[model samples]
Target: MQINQLTRVYRYDGIDLPIPPHLADDPQGLRAYHATLYPAILNAETVDAGVIGTTHVTEYRRAVGTKG
Candidate 1:
């Protein structure tokens, strides 16, 4: 769960659709959906690259990095 990224499980005629990155390329639709569904799981995704022994996980939708 992450900020900006909303998790939506949509049911239409008993069919479930997954809308994970709602605000990425479609913010308007995401907003509209948010207004209606009022999502249950909402969280902000963050990454920590300052740690000494580790790996950093970041959303490409928000941050960019390169590794060699």
Candidate 2:
């Protein structure tokens, strides 16, 4: 199947958060929705982890940059 047809999964805190049908293809909207569930996500970075078993895995990685 094409990448677009694959199910998108957001991995956060060792939990998988599947994207809602309504928020499909809306990256910004999905971020906003996810932030509601995980406030820390507001500052997190979206990292694409590639496909795995028919699922497009993505990770919300916490930003850790030292202010220099």
Please count the clashing residue pairs in each candidate, in the order shown.
Answer: 6, 0
After the best TM-score superposition of candidate 2, give how far the Cα of residue 23 lies from its true spot, in angstroms: 0.8
Whole-model Cα lDDT of every candidate shown, in order: 0.36, 0.88
Per-residue lDDT for 33-61 in model 2, tens only? 99989998999988999999888899999
Model 2: clashing residue pairs? Answer: none
Give me the displacement of residue 10 in model 2, in angstroms.
1.0
lDDT of 2 at 19: 80
Residue-level error in angstroms, candidate 1, position 54: 13
Off by over 4 Å in 2: 1-5, 65-68
lDDT of 1 by residue, 1-68 (tens): 64343333333323333455746457456535543553321222222223233322222122235645
The TM-score measured for candidate 2 stands at: 0.80
Model 1 scores a TM of 0.23
Estimate candidate 2's alpha-carbon lDDT, on a 0 to 1 scale: 0.88
Q: What is the C-alpha RMSD of each candidate to the true structure, in Å?
A: 16.1, 2.9
